[model samples]
Target: MPINKQQVRTALTHVMHPEMEKDLVTLDMIEDLIVQDSFITFTIDLPEKNSQLESHLKEKCEEAIRTYVDEGAVLDVTTAVNISKFRDREDGRGEEQAFPGQGHRKKKKRQKDEGEEELLSGVKNVIAVASGKGGVGKSTVAVNLACGLARTGAKVGLLDTDIYGPSIPTMMDTHERPNITTQKKLIPLKKYGIRFLSMGLLVDPDQAMIWRGPMVTSAVKQFMEEVEWGELDYLVLDLPPGTGDIQLTLVQTVPLTGAVIVSTPQTVALDDARKGVAMFKKVNVPVLGLVENMAYFIPEDRPGKKYHIFGKHGARDLAERIGANFLGEIPLEQAVRESGDAGKPIVLEEGLESRSAQAFVELSNNVIQQLAIRNQSKDPTEKIDIKIRP
Candidate 1:
């Protein structure tokens, strides 16, 4: 039988992107699809050209087509990177916000009137994992933190509010669509004992999210209020890097208990990490601490030797300078990276045996301790025992 466009699309949905962990069809990557008798062709659109991702996805798409279509079918897949549609729309005014380190100062706005904001009911504390810039392993820290907290038997919810670069779905290895409850709340996806949600799950992965300030804020507000995050002891929000619209909207919308800043042991990253702490303070959110990721590299062959790749204790000094707690430092490790890419966090995959996994556990314990000191609330440790379930 001849191949059809609908059949091709259905097949494509099973072809998960290696990095995105979402199907091409869901990412809106499949474009200009044409099918003839036992022959099919489609264009895979990308926001940027990733030769590795493109090649991997192309192979997956071809494999999927063959499985769904008749034997001896011919498939032609093309790749295109078009970001024009995703460009920021400018009004009569010039650029909306200043670039990083270029005197980006936003006037602090007062909190909204009472009753204007809705809280996620039953969530005891909300913690945000944020960085001043990207490539500092903020998402990785957020994911592992959530898993670590869950390992402590706390009911945890991971909310990926990095709308522009949502990576939680891929890191957590979940691609299931959420179902709406009878009360009209969206059910959160579960993995590694943590309930989570991300824009990657709700929208096409391949499409660039070029939403304006208002739109970005609205989506985050909805995610915070509309999702049925039931009785969470700790709700960790993986915020997008920088103090942009999403960051402002989140702090303004919800009463954040605290924020954990992630940064590398590099001057540039430390500079941005300071800005992250400042932003939270501007919004009256407590800066719980700073976590230094990729702090050092320990050679696998020589475990005793430590090399300061980015710089030694850069984040620790920054934390002290900013008057925030120095949570802990996570070393550079291949296991951590491989675990995240495989859709399972290292904290859950490695347990307490490995050094990287132990760091995450220590980080989680410190977070709980800091919150106790900050809020003087009941001891979280007393409420739940430490139980790391696979």
Candidate 2:
């Protein structure tokens, strides 16, 4: 039997908006429902913008249509959220009569954001060291950057937000867990003149975090809210790769000074690096700059020979195209990895004034200069608003 619009509507009747607790048909959310042969197209007009809800609703609606209407039916279900729907109210109607949390989410979010700001009021700057994808030495860069800043007389704190695959504990070298204060706050572990924390410390060394998005985000939230990060000039956050739940959580949790994007000088890494820059730009976070790690091979025996290992200047070109500052390049040196394994940042390795350590020193200087420029020109960056997709 050929499917009709009535069957499609009937199928959607089984699809209830989770937040609204009403069927699509009853809520009048299904719009422009059309059926042509086995081809079906419709629009879901949500009461508010909730991307997680949008994806969930779309999946359920597609399943309902396939199971109830026609198993072989082709779907072209699209979704939209009209902000005006929440704004435009009748002369005598309440927001609850319109949509739950439609009008009040922003206000509540703003208040929570303010409280978060107060929680970290002692910290002067929150710098997030990140990348578009993993495995480009982001953690190494973060460790060295934090150490480098601390070397310059700036009080520094390093928070490893890579919940699933945290390496900060190994890199920073101390397996000691943070101490809980009498006031119910966590005192971060201190090493090499900087305080640090990581998920690795709170769990068994071989234990895996088989957690969902909500669980990971909840852990990050706890880190943000419950840590006693006392007065500090710089707090460097080592973020997990690819902008996801934790990245969104950070933006919503605190006022970020800016982000430092780490990448290799290759098309593959630069591709994701571009997205990293765009992510910061989208969330209104100033991109401090881009750092090219493993830019070339520098053999210990040869003091002054440059090997274009991952192609030359790919990240720098990307920075140019995207109008982001090219912070500095870190040459590949064996001691960099050796230092990391020994639980010490390469920049802090005494008497080893190699090109790699010097690169990090210069990178740290560039970051400070960029921070000065960003602060002088623009106002302090606020916590991102609720409109962005998490």
Question: What lDDT is obtained when candidate 2 is compared to the true structure?
Answer: 0.78
RMSD for each model, in Å, please?
A: 18.0, 22.1
Tens-digit lDDT string for candidate 2 (98-128) = 3221222223335565445554666667889
C-alpha lDDT of residue 265 in model 2:
91
Instruction: Evaluate model 1: give its lDDT.
Output: 0.76
The candidate that wins on TM-score is 2
Question: Backbone clash tally for model 2?
Answer: 0
Q: Tell me the lDDT of model 2 at 272.
A: 90
Candidate 1 lDDT over 269-326, as tens digits, reads: 9999988888887877778899999999999999999999999999999888867899
The prediction achieving the highest lDDT against the true structure is 2
